[model samples]
Target: MPVLQTVTRETFWTIGPVGEAAFYYLAAVAILVFLYGVYARISEYAAAPADPFDRLDDLPGRVARATRLLLSNEAQFDRDTYAGVMHTFLVWGFLTLLIGTTILAIDMDIWTKLLGQPSFFVGRFYLSYSLVMDALGLLFVVGVGMALWRRYGVRESRLWGKHTDLEDDAFVWTLFALGVGGYVVEALRILGTGFPDFETVSFVGYALALLGQEAGISPATAETVYAAVWWSHSLLALGFVALLPYAKPVHMLTSMANIVTRDEQAGKRLPGVPADLPPDEIGTGSVDDFTWRERLDQDACTTCGRCSSVCPANEVGRNLDPRDVILDLKAYREERAAGEAEEVPIVADGGESVIDAESMHACLSCMACMDACPVDIEHVKQFTGMNRRLTESGEMDPHVQDAMMNVFQQGNVFGDPARKRPEWTDELEFEVPDAREEDVDLLWYVGDYPSYDERNERVAQSLARIFEAAGVSYGILYEDEQHDGNDVRRVGEEGLYEMLVEDNAAAFADAQFDEIVCTDPHSYNTFTHEYPEMAEEFDYPVSHYTEVVERLVREGQLPLSPALGQTVTYHDPCHLGRMNDVYEAPRDLVRSTGATLAEMPRNRADSFCCGGGGGGVWTEVEEERKPSEERLREAVEDTDGAVEQFVVACPMCTTMFEDGRKTGGYEEDLEIVDLTELLVEAMEAAAIDGADDTGRTGAAAD
Candidate 1:
């Protein structure tokens, strides 16, 4: 019922003369080792090629944000709730314990020695500090216990891979030992010193001490046990610090630095290949090719495996393992740094190289891994850089090459005639103006799929209808428009992507539009996210069609009444949902159709990819089942048989689901349609029903 406020306590309560002197010797050695480890790791980062953090602006803001994120681990908690709670407890506990030790050191070495100044760790402050520190130590143990359970209890956990790795095991337990051992020293000290008044403050220690008394241990023996345990705890702590340079446990020190200095780029920014890559440079051939931030990313990994758990490639049984890639890179880099002559394990890890053409081709660039990663390692960026070099070497996936060739031959990836892009527009009841022909409010960037794919062309037409209904003045580039280069850069053909960016920028310049609106999320992501530097003068706002439709419906510009009343499910396109944060718009548009929106388990930021992003649609993944089919099955399962439609916004997603329906044999079970199609149907139905109501009311009155 009462809180233990504070009490006076000696700083070095248990240590004998030898033990007291031994502490300084061990600490000095630990300090030297820690400095060496920090320096060596710093040098490794300094030598890296890309330092994304260097480009960050708003220093005060970045620092303040970093402080909050690092202290609270809120970013991790936002997505991974259970683990976040565990980690938050562990991190804060360790910090509080460290503060306790520092304050004790100050009491002994600084405050007590200062003339006329009383030590802060006395009376109420000491009792409260001791109690909080004891509680935090228990908290630390609980967190570590949960981590152990998670790593071992779950059969298919990503953490098992790291735990099973023989090399990291010792380091893992060493840190674990340091965390759990401190309490042991405290218990013995309390039993020997007979600190009954302080029992409430260090209750965990008191409990253990009580057990020792019941066992009939004498005070003299308890003193001996206390000294022995104290020395062991101190030595282990020193050893843990010393082992930082030799083990992955260094993440405890480096992850915070990496978190604070993390880059400004997120899901929106893909790694761009500079035209000026060194003539002899082989991308990711060694760790040096990566930037300091990326190399620092290696040290930042906690072996939590959150990234791999959400990775679509791994989910679909692809050879690419996001977690393994980082671990392999760290191991190989360390080997190389140690001057071993063996070829770097980076290009090939085990039987398969994560950087190999086969593995590299499997990535969807969906940002699922990045979204799930607590440490914020740029897995996609690193993989894409390697894939790009592989493409330059003519080692790209064959299906992807065909698509790239299509871009070269035609302005789009479909290799269809440029004139056919706008042919679908002829069927529209109203004229969709040409941006190149006249000034318009929005320039519609008809990407490769909607312009040519028969399935998506209809969706594009439906979207145009919605625009017309909203009284939007929109136009298209028609034959002049080119691909937005999102997937091109993702597929690692930076050279070709640049050509596409330049061509599209030229067409955009020629088009007299106030802003850019696109049906394809890939184009929307690139034009707004990736191409501002390319088109500086044409600084028009780039937005996806769902955003436009959602706004129109919200503003009463597009009247809609739910007609079908069918239960609908929405599939978030990776580019649109996770990458661009456009989850709400499509959902809004779907609900406006009077359709009940059923949600699959993995929606919003956790949305499953349709398996078309990062040119996955063009690549031949060797999985028995594609992600899109699995996603379709998930939608079906979530709806419990009532869902009438699966609504999507991205054209690539439309095509992926269409093909998947046939391949997965779900053609009769579900239907895939665009969000715009639903909105259009709802708007037209509202119009017809309004007119019918007017006529019926007049007839009744007459």
Candidate 2:
């Protein structure tokens, strides 16, 4: 093959002095408007309160990570492959075009104009640039086509949300015009040049030029067409730039900033209210109450309903839609910016509330929204803040208020006497040692549900049997243990949550143990993540029961017989799998029980909530269907009749699924068994009953 000759194109071939001057003047105005928009946005964000958790450490590392996520579209791809491909094409394609334009500007304005240097818009470089620009521009147009098709042709519901505006159309159409128009202008330019051999490197343009020639377009006419098309394309692009900050495409900048500054532990670990905060200002009452990062989150939202689509509350037809929550906040922010500064409530009852009380109460706080958000918006955190104000103002749910009162009066949500906390251990062959009185290797923090709820009490008993069979030295805080405050905190009762935390911390401080292990994922989450924030000396390592059980099974500490031979599906408790990232261990444990682990449609990180979190267990919301019922149906139907047993590690999941199993009439089809129950069955099949070394029936030998 012959070596291709160098090719170059004229930047202003058809434009006269007057046209060039007009172009420059318009370009300057567009640039100034763009800069002003950017500055105004930055100033608006800066004016908001600082995010307590938004630490600026490791900025370079953060930028690098954010760049990787943006370039790879990993998070977006994880949700939808079509969207991922379209977004990647659009981003990289548009970026390449922008870069090519910037290079042209540098060559013309900087190298030649300022330094009087020879223009480098020639030789192999220009040829390569032309080829790359043509190829990527085609991709850019394809991305625009895909976007339009997805939004309009396929009519993807996730793309259109409550806050979706005409601006969305404007953004997409402008992009479509610019991308297609650029190629049209290039084709016109090539056609005017008589389809030169070197211009073939701009293959799309060359092909279009050849087509135009075949259609009987003369060179003079092509030149005339080029001038008008070039001017239109340029102006369209400039107008897009000028309108950037005011349109849906503003996410282009805000998203990058949001992602770069995102808290990795956002939903998993929430920021607590400052002690000095006034009673009236406990939560986000108005626009001014939100942190700068949260305000940035509002702007960063691309109006994609990924968060709402994945939300269990929304999925179950509850009033809470995470996308609406963010967009509502954004609308309020804009309204506030436009001079509505009367300290209006963000969430209120029967008033001109930006977010309604029902929507606030409807949130499950399962972090499903946060998990689905590609822009890394902390939907859980934002809602939790709003909940604080609700709780402070006594506008919270009646059941939640009762639960809070129960927690305050009885140290548990069940309102059971403290003496009854250890009653679950009565039927067990072994006695769970009191951690306050005994020194043990593992301090088992038996959470409220396991200690009080009869069904979950059986699960706690099963765990006790497993501990006995494994010969693990574990003790419980029993009556001394208060509630973990995980759900309380999530429900927006920060003061009550702190009170519980302090009470639990005091119990922990008195307990003598090497490490703390929790039966409930909710308890484990707060113990491992939130507890240390309040209790500085709270240094004991914490683990969910699954982690400890998995280790024991791995170490051959538990007697194993895969004789169950049943097909089972594991329900990922949101706090365990999504919040804590302890997915594999429970699945491994299920497999270890000689059961075939059939996964549901959504599992692990994408696991559906059981409608038991964010005080969903405490508050009653009449919905078309419960999230737990939906989850059970998913397990029963989605697994193609393979799942006979629905195994879960969380007591909350057990409570919810059991209730759902009855309510959904799925009791005949599925059994909601806990991980500990399965483990006990597996060990019992191996002939290892709860027998101790001293032959005292594994009870506390007094």
- Residues 1-702, candidate 1: write the lDDT tens digits: 124334565546667667677788889889898889789878877666655436356767767877788788876786577778888878888788888888887777677766546677666777778789889888888887776666666643677774357655676566578777887777777777775676667888888778878899777788877767777878887887787765777787777776667665665776554557763353565656768877777778878778888887888888878888877777667767787746642453225443556677788889898888776777877787677667666677788889889888887788888888888888778887878888999888878888888888898888888888788888888889887889988887777877888788888888777778888888888887778765576577988888887888899999898786788898888888887788888887787778988888899998988889888888766569998888988887765557768888888899889889889988888788888788878888999999999999999999
- Residue 221 C-alpha lDDT in model 1: 86
Q: How displaced is residue 390 in candidate 2, in Å?
A: 0.6
How far is each candidate from the true structure, as Cα RMSD in Å?
Answer: 2.8, 4.0
Model-by-model lDDT, in order? 0.78, 0.88
Off by over 4 Å in 1: 1-7, 50-56, 113-120, 154-156, 278-282, 344-354, 639-641
Enumerate residue pairs that collide in model 2. none
Instruction: Give the per-residue lDDT of model 2 (tens digit) for 1-702.
Output: 124334577899899889988998999999999999999998987888999885578999999999999899998897699889988899889999999999999999899999999888887888889999999988889999999999999899878876788888988899999998988898898889888788889999888888999999989999988888999999999999998987787999999999999998897778988889899988989778889899989999988889889998888888888888898888877877787655577888778888899998888889988888899988888999999999889898999889989999999999989999999999987677878888999999998999999999998898898888799999998889899999999988888888888888888888788889899999998988888988898888999999998999999898877878899999899999999899999988888878998889898899999999999888766656888999999998899557889999999889888888888889899898998999888887767433433456445566
Global lDDT of model 2: 0.88
- Which structure among the candidates has the greatest TM-score? 2
Each candidate's number of clashing pairs is 4, 0
**TM-score to true structure, per model:** 0.94, 0.96
Best by lDDT: 2
